[model samples]
Target chain A: MTAHPLHVPPGPVDLDAIATDATPGYGGSKSDGKAALEGLGPELADLQERLFAEGRATGSRRRVLLVLQGMDTSGKGGTLRHTVGLVDPQGVRISSFKAPTADELAHDFLWRIRRAVPAPGYLGVFDRSHYEDVLIARVNELAAPEEIERRYDAINEFERELVEDGTVVLKCLLHISKDEQRERLLARLDNPEKYWKYEPGDIDARARWDDYRAAYELALERTNTAHAPWHVVPSDRKWFRNLAVGTLLLDALRGLDLGWPAADFDVDAERARLLASEAST
Target chain B: MTAHPLHVPPGPVDLDAIATDATPGYGGSKSDGKAALEGLGPELADLQERLFAEGRATGSRRRVLLVLQGMDTSGKGGTLRHTVGLVDPQGVRISSFKAPTADELAHDFLWRIRRAVPAPGYLGVFDRSHYEDVLIARVNELAAPEEIERRYDAINEFERELVEDGTVVLKCLLHISKDEQRERLLARLDNPEKYWKYEPGDIDARARWDDYRAAYELALERTNTAHAPWHVVPSDRKWFRNLAVGTLLLDALRGLDLGWPAADFDVDAERARLLASEAST
Candidate 1:
């Protein structure tokens, strides 16, 4: 219920103003942060199960959507592996958006995203979500400037509809420095195990870092809503990033005030039926 | 690859003949088995990443399909939580099939099953699969006797096509006894946290335990092939069940002989470009 320290406040957004290595709310060594994340498993799992139960038993539409956006190698994949991995996979619905296909391009940008929305009682995660329409689409001049302007309003309205329909949208921008990204890209090229992650086009994107940052600043400012606030996650330190995101998710779930759904069937009757059936067997 | 001890051999599979509490391959205490499963994390994660990388880099059709079929509360969901949870969720596509809708029923049973198959380089998991058509349909006469008879061959052919097209189907029958089912169902009833899982219909299914067992025995025998053999996992103990399924998945991934996919681009040239870009910035 309290304000999250990492929540991007309403203002003119500046990517350069925030330090990427700052562990804003958490004060711990890497091991301490890791252990804290591990400790959160039980509570997070229980709350998630309760949410899942509420949806199934009562057909409640309440759900959570975690939208992750960042530059290449900003640890979207790592966030999924460590932080999001804490909950039961069955309760999570993850969709990674790549370049749109022919069919996707033919329709509105939100067309594909709508199809991937989490069903009732799911923790939906979008890695490189519809934000791409404004980010990459803006940086590359893939769409007209006026059209790009229109999309910001379109996205805000779409997200508002989701919130009204019992969805909690948690948007996180995995903020990292250019220096950190350079190091990570080099490391990927250095290690054979990580080589599969490196693509030449990543350099092309990196070259336009300033343009991407400007694009992000505009997008974050234009689309930042009270209902679906964006959190700028400082992701230079992997451990802290995971801890922050995990805490953010934990807080969002706690806000829901989820509890075990009450039994719909008569407990005594079910018990009697079970015993009678056992005896007959 | 060495033969897995829990694999059902080519012959009649007597559900009564197999002891439900037996932990055939695991030689450890509950904590030890849990630790052993945990020990598999790094290796399992690496292999899964490689499988995912191969799919992305080369457009390789090689994939895995882990089909889990069992009575309710047979630890299918547990296996997913503890075992499949070890892998990167990005690479794992899980589909849990419930009762078919009017649209689903209008088509062949395999039609829905086919739509949920894993894409290239994915670890696909089905909580309950097409085998349900034979199991439940046969038990309740949901289909005509002749139609149920025809589905056995249809399933075999469908699976064979998946295998031939580069899917390694790992079918697991989570074997548990009638007594075990009663205890599990009772546990669900007693615990408020688990009450959501206790449907009254589960008792009805338990009442016809013998018929369900017979259905499983025949289904396993008819569909078991060299390419996709059934592993009868003794799932009475939750810890051992998690370990056995983890080991099965690890062995299946190891059998793929996966490695870091070769870089599709010139690494040195990209590295040079990266450094040059950094200098410009």
Candidate 2:
């Protein structure tokens, strides 16, 4: 089969443009994020029920890959919680990849990740993803320069392949200001309940904020394709960030228009027979 | 807090008794498993909605760990898929633990599992869990005899603590006869799509069926506390297995009587502010 050239968008879409067009500015609108969610809750509920029901009936297990990449304290976890909250659990699966195992690094970086992708008719949310090749690997100077460049190309091709074959790829970079991150880190240290989530490595990383930002910008420039465009959400206001990110995912999934596909009656007939066998003495 | 003693059911309420009473030739009703789940689909849907909504409002996550430990080809995965189908994706999370990570082995076995438990007011399902300590470890002789004994005591304490703190632990051992397992394994070999799920190791274990059964029986005996009883499900019939396991979880979670612990709403004042905000916009 011939591989299709990826349809990456021209130049990264401006974060400012996304903020203005997609989401109402934080604290500027009559309905805040919480209120908006409260208002949308019931409708979203019905939508989820219908989507999952249709998905199962048609057996159209369309795979969705939600790749979340962000700066420190950019609310990746929060967005994951909210966005996943809006979908059907049965039709979704999440895989959070941490530092690689020895076996993982021994092979291609994509080896472990490819195994984790959602099967058809499901959503797979990645807490941090293959972008680490560009982000952390670059930031730490871990990859030889040439290998790093190759990964960017492979990722573009990989995403294109998945999208072409019915996987929906939605990538997000939750962008928070350096100042806001410092404040959040301090708060995490202060709050005992959140203490377990913090590590000393986080403080070391915070010290290199500018380097990380540059890496992220380069990653975005190279990888933002039409099939999987990156949404640089201004997460200075988490409430606004949640609303914007939630809207993006809710829209993309709805865009799929995955009404139930036709199923042969044989399985249904067999299922009835199976159930009947149980009922009969 | 003083750790409580393990709470076993008095006399005949344990899995052994249940198994004996449930055996078809032992004069128990044939369809007890199927009958238990008669109205479960709707009930589970309703439970999932309430569970997710509670997670949102309270931000206190709870977990539903569905520990499915059974004999080879005892329909564990099928039961999991069928049951999760009835749950809302938002409030539920499922983790399938395979081989241990290096980090997992470095700590107590339960350490990795504890991290995966749902935050608060959420449901977490484990297809196979730390019980593998007794099952696979015993089967493979992976641990020293002393360590194996220590783990059972540790698991009992671990489960008791989770129950005390509000995690609803529902454990199911899908019990299928030796003859039935051979049938399912043959079916897996017969189907192309199911080939990936079949491992050759399964057949070797099938060869040692009695050893595995002894291991499972010991596991159920040591850890079946009132808070987390072991439900020895008759899984010879895959459909009935799914229904029984799903209904068991539904019954346990529904028994919790979970509702939105009253939100502190300043009703009149908030209504006025809401109206005024709408007017100003």
Candidate 3:
């Protein structure tokens, strides 16, 4: 196995030195990788059904969230369309965090993210999540150095609460090279079909790439917790990125002690009544 | 024309007297209605494009919000799937408000709603919106009667601000009969497939049907402002319901003076450069 381990355990790590293209745990060909990704769909769907069913039936509410943080054109949307797309849209809650609105900026940063967090049985995907506070806010000097430092602790406490309340939190930092980003942005500008996806401000973000990277490094080191560890996925290869995320979801789901809630109703009587009604109608 | 009118202009309306199956503006057969719905897709698509485009371009940032309020099984989800379904999902933002969390309940009712209103160039749908404050809160006596009264004015003022800020606010109350709701609930109970969608708490809501109706009547009469009027939708018939909302959305879209934004970039130069870059790559 070429060691591109995607999951970073709660510990000290240097994001600056991590290879964005490393596929440490993947030992498969591109064909095998794609096949593996496709294969996980059924398991995910089944797990989601059980989770959703459980939430409806009982007091214990189980939820899963994937928090995605990345640079411009780092395949967040692609991951959404491919990985989360496999689940029932009804069971999935996707909250894409754009630049905060004036109203949102007035409140705490997590206010919007907290509202959008998946309810029990939902598989939530944060397209660009609360990590923006640390990444963008830090890089742009939007907040003071000390205040930026304080966000790391606040985020950890929040995730701890989510985990305590039965929500599995998996954060992924999509690590892509600046060169790859330039190519992607150029592709967007070049393709008329993709012009809608382009924003002139993305170029502004791109200009602050190094500063953003430094900010990300600090975020990963400071906030990554045992409860909500950050996984820096090598995202230069889009295929590998999807496969890695899909596998992580599959593992998290399968690890849960999950089952369908037993139906409390008299099914035979209900079924008979429905049949009688249908005949009468 | 089998007239099934969709829009309810701002006015005093009696919820008790309002027909749950009134389709005065819809004069078509089922097949005709479905076709008209299918037919509106492209124009809705076009209007949505212009709305979304206008937002992305400089200066003018127009938007729309369709707030759906109804009793349990009144087909809010169906409307979302069928009516809002016609537009590009990318251009649509759907916020399904559930029971507020401890954190949310701590704040004012409109806090979460204000956060979820669509950005410029987006058509936002509230699957069960702030009206819950007045409906459920009033029906359950969750707040003091005086406090409940305050929310109506608060909602109107909140909505007025949204209108003043360039969002076309359309509120729809999907009015389904108590008899119709009973049938829907029984259907869910009878069919195993629908058991997931059936919440046990719905029966409790069903029990308070009259109270809820009274609450709805008061809400409709009080908050039906010229700025953000409430339309009582005849949702007992699903197809008519879908068609009515679709037509309402189409009319709202057409009502807007929208056009594709002129390109801000040097299109010819950008295109030529993209073409040249493609050749080199």
Q: What DockQ, between 0 and 1, does each candidate earn?
A: 0.60, 0.07, 0.11
Q: Which stretches of candidate 2 lie over 4 Å from their true place?
A: A1-64, A67-91, A95-123, A126-168, A171-223, A230-281, B1-38, B59-63, B278-281
Please report the TM-score between candidate 1 and the true structure.
0.95
Standalone chain B TM-score for every prediction: 0.96, 0.84, 0.94
lDDT of 2 by residue, A92-158 (tens): 6776677888899998988988988876656678889999878889889988999999998899999
TM-score of each: 0.95, 0.56, 0.71
Better of 2 and 3 by TM-score: 3
Candidate 2 chain B: worst-modelled 10 consecutive residues by lDDT? B1-10
lDDT of 3 by residue, A174-272 (tens): 889876776887787766646666666676677677778778878888887888888889988888898888877877888887876766666566544
Candidate 2, residue B108: the lDDT equals 84
Q: How accurate is candidate 1 locally (lDDT)?
A: 0.88
Candidate 1, B-chain TM: 0.96
Clash count list over all predictions: 0, 14, 16
Per DockQ, what order, best first? 1, 3, 2
| Candidate 1 local lDDT, B1-281, one digit each (tens) | 11133888787888777878888855678888888889998999899989999998887899999999899889899899898899888888888899999999999999999999999999999999999999999999899999999999999999999999999999999888777887888888899888888898898888788899899999989988987889998888888888888888999899999988888899999989998885423
List, residue by residue over B57-120, the lDDT tens digit for candidate 3. 6477579999889988999887876777666555677788988989899999989888898888
**CA lDDT, candidate 1, residue A57:** 78
Who wins the lDDT comparison?
A: 1
Off by over 4 Å in 1: A1-5, A279-281, B1-5, B279-281
